[model samples]
Target: MTSISMAGTGSGLVLTASWQDTVPATLTVRAPGQGDGATPERPLVEVLTSRHGRDWAGPRYVATSVGQRLRYRSHELTSSGSWQTLSLTQTDAVTGLDVTSYLSIHDEHLAVRSWTSLYNNASEPVTLHAVSSLMFGDFGAADIDQMYLLRGRSDWLAEGRWSRERLRDAGLPDLTTPGRPFRTRGCIEASSLSSWPTAQELPTAVIGDDSTGTHWSFQIEHNGGWLWQVGEVPDGLYLALFGPTDEHHGWQLELLPGATFESVPVSLAIEGDGTLDAITGFRRASRAPGGGPGLPVVFNDYMNTVMGDPSADVLHPLIDAAADSGAEYFVIDAGWYADNGDWWDAVGEWQPSTRRFPGGIGEVLEHIRRRGMVPGLWLEPEVVGTNSPMALKLPDAAFLQRGGERVTEHGRYHLDFSSVQAVDHLNEVVDRLVNDLGVGYFKFDYNIRAGVGSDSVAASAGHGLLRHNLAYLAWIDSLRQRHPQLMLENCASGGMRQDFATVSRFDLQSTSDQEDLYAYAPIAASAPMLILPEQAANWAYPQPDMTDDAIAFTLCTAILGRLYLSGWLDKLSDDQRLMVAAAVRAHRELRDSIPHCLPFWPTGLPRWTDQWISLGLRDVGGDALYLTVWRRDTEPGQVDLTLPPAPDGMRWDYPSAVFPVESPLRIEGEPSGGTLRIVDVRGSHAARVVKLRSVPVE
Candidate 1:
């Protein structure tokens, strides 16, 4: 038998694999000083084909015939700067199929990205039903009962709602009875269907060892269908991540002789501290170069403002107020292109409305620029309204269709970016908007889900959808290349498409379409756990009718992340307007350090009905900490929060000063680790932002 181990230079993670002449290769990952170095019994790669099915009758992805027959062939290790990659090659002798699994990690990140490519070397065709992107056994040394599972659920108005449950409670039973060795057929699975990756269930999960405080977190980096499962096997607990499956998504591909197929990419992060640390590592590995663009304060005319029915007179004052309140970009949301108020179904022409903007839409965009802010427009670029002229003008092949008919949803037809006609048409629209109308930013929104997939020009409907998803990302890359200075925001009915696949590419992500300030607190606080704080655009729509405390509460929700300002700022009194300005100023002062700060939750993950929620951003140096806390309707005037160890001689202060009328904060216990007491004398429905700074003992 031969064994190989690779260690991350700075991450302190170890990957070990073992194989022999008659045994299949097995792989496992663990952090430093975690678990005994036992050889995993499960195979490194799992593949299900039409010819070879599962060896054991179960719903899990492991214990497949092809997976158990794959023997180790060769391995290679390569590195470039801080990044290192390890490729393991395995082959099934009977079927003449080869699998090359690639694992890449950064020296500074305790996360690993994994994927596999399959090549058919036989003479006949190979029908693939499912292929695992990543698989590993013996996740933690503790028993299954002592571990917990964490998952997130998201929707239109409610996004980033996370829940934690024990492994047994999450539907995975412990079948380790003495004398009788039986593996259960059930597993804990989280999956996303159709085009909206994050509409129903988020493609991220975490398994924590309650006794040891260790955590394992993972995320599927796909914009379409994805599935992840955790199940028990004879050897130990196993995890499998995949892009799509024949059973769940009807995704099957036939590989002809010498044909190759690559699986979707997935990431795994491990930490001994807690689940939040694992997530922080995962977020760091998923970031792009320079960690995205600057956090510019954006103001949109939607969500409690004009509510998508904007007119020249209505937008003129809002634009002026947004500029006066220190907004850097002003986006004219939906209905700007509608000739009438009924703009939902007649959208694809990309023309200014004559009735809504009698002076021309250009007038409002020019007004935005005159007030010293970049002009932006809201666009749903991936769909053509059924009643739109472009629906008839574009070729039938340019849109996604199944069974020879166009796929329609919510009065719109999904566009296939693989088609030249579709790309060319959107290219022209964007060029015209940028070159002719002087628009500098775009809020790209997607409002519909193209069911199953498109069967036009592909092996299956699921395959067709997967191809289009990749093409759409490539199109965005090309668009950025053409207009290098332009900023783009990704919005899918408000975060339905909030995945690393999109967040890593877009400048900002609209966290939600949630309109109520009171309910939006938890969503805003939980967003940084999934995406970078600099890229999370939380809306703070403080209206003139809201009280001073309520205005501060809404502003506090946005100050820690990308401040998205809205509401009727023009109608606000002088004091109210100043509060909004103060919030923007505070965000600007701290935005530069946001990209370098790691996120933590002092009060655990927020529940939908939780009265108190807190999110903290700690700097890399551990000297500065910015904490935002929200208190919903409750009888208690103060709440005690458990915080991480602070630097020696550190003191708490309110940095934003937006809530000067609120009570001061108090700390108890030792300076290293203590409880923070936050008092909101105004009581229920109030929020505050405080900073902890290190002071020299003079």
Candidate 2:
């Protein structure tokens, strides 16, 4: 093999391409000190077509003939400021398809964003079964036993549950031998097949080499169907990230002559310490600068407060209480667009309800503004209820269909954004809300899953759905262009669609809908692993009837992220109200630093039954560190936490009022790297936020 060309970023990450006379060209990336002795290489892009299928038979998505026939054509490298981009083009003689793969990286970051574009120059049409956005083969470096795979599982109320297992434990066996050679046909895979990307599993994973202390993390940046897999090869282990496949998502695209298609983007990060370090770098490279919408303190009347039944009478007092508590935005959640109480099947027309708001919803919105807060409302724009009047009004072509009938799920028809009428209707609704009602924020919620896809004007149902998904994102981009100052919150029944494709565009993401405060601890602690800390909207619903410790526990859950306040604040007791206010103040004081801070867990990733969970945020410059600790039921009163190097001063930042000197609530530790002991005599259902400041050692 001969090295053709090499490109290196200022971050010390290098990409090298090598080719042999007979074998196809291959590309490999190396970290700062990673020597190229044992690194395995793979093709620039792996693609599968209907006519020419995989060379090796397996359920896996690799070894396609189209990928093997690709020959290196040319490459280009460009740089601008601190960012560098490398584009490598390849061609297949048999298919006459040109594949261009792009890799982008920041000078100061150890991560790369990758995607591929394919153009069909053939005279005949080619049906694509699968196309990988990114594929690499150096994950385990020929040693499968030394690798650990980490994946996250998510659901409606239980989101961000992560688990780590060895390669053998994760269903990939060591099939290599000294005398004989064989490759495994099976792989460890995770995929999403519906509109809710994260409905079952998060589109992120970490591959850690336990022997070398090196970690590699990657995430598929798609809002709809996606698939990622790790499998064993003859040389080593390979990881493939893809948008959708015919086998997994029923997606197939017929590429006509002179047509082009671009795969979804994926981000990869490499670090030498731990999985969290890799995730930190991934978030830094992927998240937008300044963290979207300035990390405002949002108070939405939904969760435990109004429960989707908001009325002017019920919101007036809550609006005043939220404003007094220092909430910057007040959101009137679901049921505001319904005239009658049974609003489940009558949705579609997003007008103010005459019965719920007799004086008009605009009056209530005005009251929110008068209380010194931006007014927002909840909207599920993708679905129109079957009983809604708009159902008859919208054309059949505007909705997802199958077998000449509209697809209905949960008593609603999924709107296909591929239709211009659908997009225009939504544009009118948004314009009216922003122009007339003065709504500055929108909590865009999605409550139904459009199963399989629409088989309308496409080769496959999944292809049609993918087109609609792209159109939906395009609509969001247009919306942002029109209302540049409007803040948008992404919510798919709480964290279902929580992927970078949406999170990178939206201002905030609802973490979960877990109503139990105690049960929400793990979700909040694990949220920053996938979603950016500033965009993670964890709910802190402190009710009037809760104990002081319970209220503090719930408030502490949200202080570390975007403080999404809820609960009946108007009905809270005086002391409880003060605690809530103190939490808000602490968040406001630290929100400026939240966007720049990377997350760390002292006690490891949280488990649902874990007694204690802690989430730490350290600024990029190492100037400030904040930690939130939650003690659940049955936990001991005293627990010691291992700290990273001690800072100058460590003090309780939230619940600003100090406790009695004799009380058992105390934290003691040294100013160096040591363990800190926390004694909370309150025993269970308690939480506290602590701040540590690092000073220069002279």
lDDT of 1 at 673: 34
* Model 1 misplacement above 4 A: 289-293, 647-673, 696-698
lDDT of each: 0.84, 0.83
TM-score, predicted candidate 2 vs. hidden true structure: 0.95
Candidate 1 is scored at a TM of 0.96
lDDT for residue 205 in candidate 2, whole number 0-100: 84
Q: Which residue runs does candidate 2 get wrong by more than 4 Å?
A: 1-10, 140-142, 278-293, 635-637, 645-665, 696-698
Which lDDT tens digits does candidate 1 get at residues 291-397?
22678899998979888898999999999999999999999999988867787888898988889989898988889999999999999999999999999999889
Instruction: Give the lDDT of residue 464 in candidate 2.
Output: 82
Please write out the lDDT profile of model 2 over residues 531-612, one tens digit for every residue.
8888899999999889887888888899988999999999998888888888898888888888788888878889888887
Evaluated at residue 412, the lDDT of candidate 2 is 95
